[model samples]
Target: MVMSANERLFYHVLIRILFVAVIAGSLISLLAEQFWVAELFTHFRLYYLLLQALLVLIFLHTGRHTLMALTILFAMPNAWVAGPYLIPVYGGQRATAKAATSIDIVALNVNYRNDGFARVAGYLRERDPDIIVIAEYTPAWRDELEFLRKSHPYQFGEVRPDPWGLAVFSRLPFMESELIDLADTDTVHARFVFAAGMMSLEVFAVHLLPPKSAVWARNRNLQLENLVDQLGASTHQRIVIGDLNLTPFSPYFSRFIERTGLQDARRVDGFHVTWPVSVFPVWIPIDHALADPEVNITSVHAGPDVGSDHFPLEIRVSKGVNKQPGQVRAVFE
Candidate 1:
């Protein structure tokens, strides 16, 4: 069929718009960890739905091929929508064991200037988690958290200045603890050994640097990548718990998953938002608990507010082969 000039122009314009959107999406993914951009996209994901509706209006009026292309291309947000609660794509490994015994592990990034240490300590004691990690812990916060040592004997972490200190408290005696110092200032990674099934297992607690600028984002990505590589080589049934400050949808987070072969705590459930507790609707899943493929994740959730800008995350895991090879069975089902 002979195409009119306007029709030809429409096809060319549509292809160009799709190309640009693809590029823009890639850029956004790279910048997902930046606070300003992350906040924008968090709200954008909601408004983009409305934007899609507007696209339909434009489609009806113009019947432009470019609008059609852009409309279809907007499906990229599905990843963001489903990204928070995606199930682990653990290929081949099936977690066979149920949570015969469960341990509540909590990860919290207590804002440095938080004055609610008493409330935070009370909240932690009330939950009685088997393990707890707090980042952005200042000297005062550490002093306040020290009271929990009676219940949790095994402690490993260092108190630092404003934005980067980390601490871990556990019921199990820590057989080992060392700050990984991953060539980055904001992170404090450590391995804690615990007894399980006549063998010792190690849990690594980490708080990665927040990716703000392009340079910072790339640096954060590299630091996490290196950490994952080291952990992947470790011979422990690993449970990595902490406020990573990165979300599941971010490319860096995705790379961390691919590099470590670890499963997200919420993969089988829903996205648990944990930040800006002072601001209602300021929700994003920055805190994380990731486990090795060998570990069986039972449950993952966000805890009650402890007066920190970020809420705590609790994840329960055990060791057992899955019911079927390469199948993810619901913990309850």
Candidate 2:
């Protein structure tokens, strides 16, 4: 088979256009994350890596060395951002022996409409976490979760029909529990001062708005900023968990950690994808557990899907230091 000069020219032009488009899009995605409009794309940073990989294969087959080189170069930024997540370097020093005291937490977003209550209840029974946090908790879920009261007598937060509804159940008694509204979102903050031997811990269960639109994105950022402010002001060792609705790769997520000085448990553990469980490769880790520097994350992993779009996050933490005098208690309203 032979191609005329016109056909050759057309093919060359088409390839050039594609090369330029890939380069331009890649550049924009890498730089635009700082801007509100472009920040939404940061959620798909993993997908961008896949796209760049496919483009590399195409360029290789077409013998477009220059385009391949440029694509590889532009892809580095995304790779840099995603490397820590894909790699397991963050897992801290292995504990020679288990700590004397520990706390287990299970965080999940029970889909407001998913009726797989039995599955969720069974999973909770199997895990037997000390603290259980549920997002998108509706009136129906409250009824389904009533059995938990037998084990977790101390409950906080309210169940509502809206997706923002949040709840926390603790087997340990709470010294103080406060429900604060930030940027129109209700957040639950609690302090658990255990008996003589156990360490006092602070916990927060938050459900930020999804960034479906620019306005929503801004609001979510605002909520996160306010939450960080609250976290910064706190003196107790903290464990913050819930459906943050943002991936670890997002600029805002990075900012949240930087500002609050919380360590993401996922970094120490493997990158466990927890959203859109029905989908195979298109999943993202929107649920997270961020712990303060004083808390030791012994283990963090994802739980089985229980008829919800998001999977559960289970984290085991222990005190990093000996018990200290309690901080001034915050009013629980």
Number of the top-ranking candidate, with lDDT as the measure: 2
lDDT of 2 by residue, 144-239 (tens): 999988899988877778776778888877877867677665543333334213456677777888888777778888889888777767667766
lDDT of 2 at 122: 95
Q: What is the lDDT of residue 249 in candidate 1?
A: 58
- Cα lDDT tens digits, model 1, 1-333, are 999999989986885575455445544644555544553354334334344555556666777767556665664564455434533433223333335465567888888988888888888878777788888878999888777778888787888877778888888776677777765655667777776544556777877777666666566667777777667567666677776766665556676776666677676446567766865564777777777555666677777877888888877655443333243312210
Best by TM-score: 2
Give each model's clash number: 8, 0
The deviation in Å at residue 143 for candidate 1 is 1.8
Report clash pairs, candidate 2: none
At residue 149, give the lDDT of candidate 2: 86
Off by more than 4 A, model 1: 1-69, 80-100, 184-186, 198-200, 278-282, 319-333
On a 0 to 100 scale, what is the lDDT of residue 278 in model 1? 61
Q: What is the lDDT of residue 201 in candidate 1?
A: 63
Give the range where candidate 1 is weakest over 10 consecutive residues by summed lDDT. 324-333
